[model samples]
Target: MTSTLQPVTALTLDLDDTLWPVRPTLIAAEKVLAEWLRANAPSTAQNTPPAAMLALRAEVAAEHPHWAHDLSAIRLETIRRALRKHGDDPALAELAFDVFFEARHAVTLYDDVLPGLERLASRYPLIAVSNGNAELHRVGLERFFAGSVSARLHGVAKPDPSIFQAACAAAKAPPHRVLHLGDDLDTDVAGALAAGLHAGWICRPDGAHADAAPRAGAHRFATLLDVADALGV
Candidate 1:
């Protein structure tokens, strides 16, 4: 039951944990932000910094059930409002946002990032789809991708299919011709396959995903460079 695989004309990537390690970056940024908050908004910082920041985010998100899809807005508004209350000055609100924005831009890309992106971008249109803050792709990684989609813009997260569909549409490519690369098996592999795109799982260097046999038709690459090689371009 062998079949000829179609050439990849488009490539969609996940930002967090795929091209760059996001969780650790977020943790590091949170630490910095917590210190800043403690200095600027000491009273509220106790409940708004570090883990408390994430907890408040969840609590506020639960209040707006209709806004689960656009958590960035919720988060931004939450931070802004919390800072306003603590500082008693609207100007401090902007400072809080600036701190977060700067911290986010400090994310470290993986070792295989530039070479792989250069190789693939030279051949096909490259796009990014991530369920993170929209700004992370737009203002953050704008130089890397030709186009992008985030839950903040699409109003839905991955594993939901619509976001992937939207990314393909933005790239002007059919799902079958697009190769989706990401770290999460369910969000990237299953979701892309469900939406009819080729899926490539970006496992860790330790080969943790070697045993994960996705039921859907998919391929696994240890790094972005391997993915570039897989396409044979």
Candidate 2:
């Protein structure tokens, strides 16, 4: 165990880029959505390309600031807007979103994730805390987690202390006794610190924050295996 690290009774983990490379997963899911749209809503598909769909999603998000924490809502609205703009049935958004969501859950986890999660889960009650809509059960990783706290369900996202507190509550641990691990510096490390929880920043080589220097009062690691080793799990 690292002497410098604080003792924690439970752990909160980030999903997307921490356990898996989210870009590829999202890209593949978008492709699946496009294909489904072409088959079911040909007019909408013909009118909206991938770039246009992204713009539509952004436009919807800007129009609905209150729904910022709910990505699923934004995505569904985007699909509906596309269908409506193209003279297609907006109700088909539900089925289109379902297709996209299923593809989104088809993630390829990092090599270190399984072993690291096994080690950590054996030692601590792991709670998934995510801003994304990826479901643990769909991702086939629910068994490793005691519970999950999501922005959609909680009405707040990370960088807001409430979500982290919710995760701590789910673990039945006080903020001081709950360590939160994630890849994003702002949402994960700083957010956990702000919430009075220990922070572990897992900076994978290919991550956006990979070149970031270590911050004071936050643990930095290259992989989940490194985090497990540091925690002596």
Candidate 3:
């Protein structure tokens, strides 16, 4: 028996891997940040190996478990600690973090993303909902979205219904009317389904999420264009 699908009035999208490949973006951003560090803070740069920077992140996470949901806080604290220990001025950590943040937003969108977003945004109120720290204004996609919700500001990450609900609220729509798309099955699909939003799993070209098990009500698509086709929007 087929059930009539609910109409999609709005959308809540994941930022990191759905629109752009986040790993490469981060790797590029890290390289640019390292270059800045080498030029401006050589003492800290000499002592802080890339791996040690990761270790500092872990240390910050351990000491401040409450900040687990805020990536900016964790990264900033890690930078501050590194600057302090390496005899660099700790006050400069804020500036260093800003440098890295600017680089982080230099994302290359997937070929289909911009056109697809334009098409979808014309029909529905598109909401950018993410657990990551990407700012749409920085990414230059702020004009396409009606609103945004983030884990950092909300104090809860995805796979928790609170964030999903918050995204729905941002859209000024009920959960059942908003379709949510993301790359992570657990966070995006499971979280949206649990919160009663329409869920779509975006499996990127890398085939990284091939092992995901099917959820009863979820839609699986390769791109945002496919999402429009699937929804008949």
Instruction: Decide which is better by lDDT, 1 or 3.
Output: 3
The best candidate in terms of TM-score: 2
What tens digits encode model 1's per-residue C-alpha lDDT throughout 96-203? Answer: 767875676577778888888888888888888988763544334567678888877788889888888899998899888888998889888899999999888888
Q: Which residue pairs overlap in candidate 3's backbone?
A: none
TM-score of each: 0.86, 0.98, 0.95
lDDT of 2: 0.93
Q: Model 2, 1-233: lDDT tens per residue?
A: 77755568899999999999899999999999999999999999999999999899999999999998999999999999999999999999999999999999999999999999999999899999999999999999999999999999999999899999999999999999988999988999999999999999999887888888876799888898898888888
- Would you give me the overall lDDT of model 1? 0.76
lDDT for residue 59 in candidate 2, whole number 0-100: 98
Stretches of model 1 off by over 4 angstroms after superposition = 1-5, 47-49, 84-91, 134-141, 207-215
| Model 1 lDDT-worst window of ten | 1-10
- Say which prediction, candidate 2 or candidate 3, comes out ahead on lDDT: 2
Consecutive 10-residue window with the lowest summed lDDT within model 3: 1-10
lDDT of 3 by residue, 70-173 (tens): 99999899999999999989998899999999999999999889888988888889998888899999999999999999999999999899999988998999
TM-score computed on alpha carbons, candidate 1: 0.86
lDDT score of model 3? Answer: 0.87
* Two-way TM-score contest, 1 vs 2, winner: 2
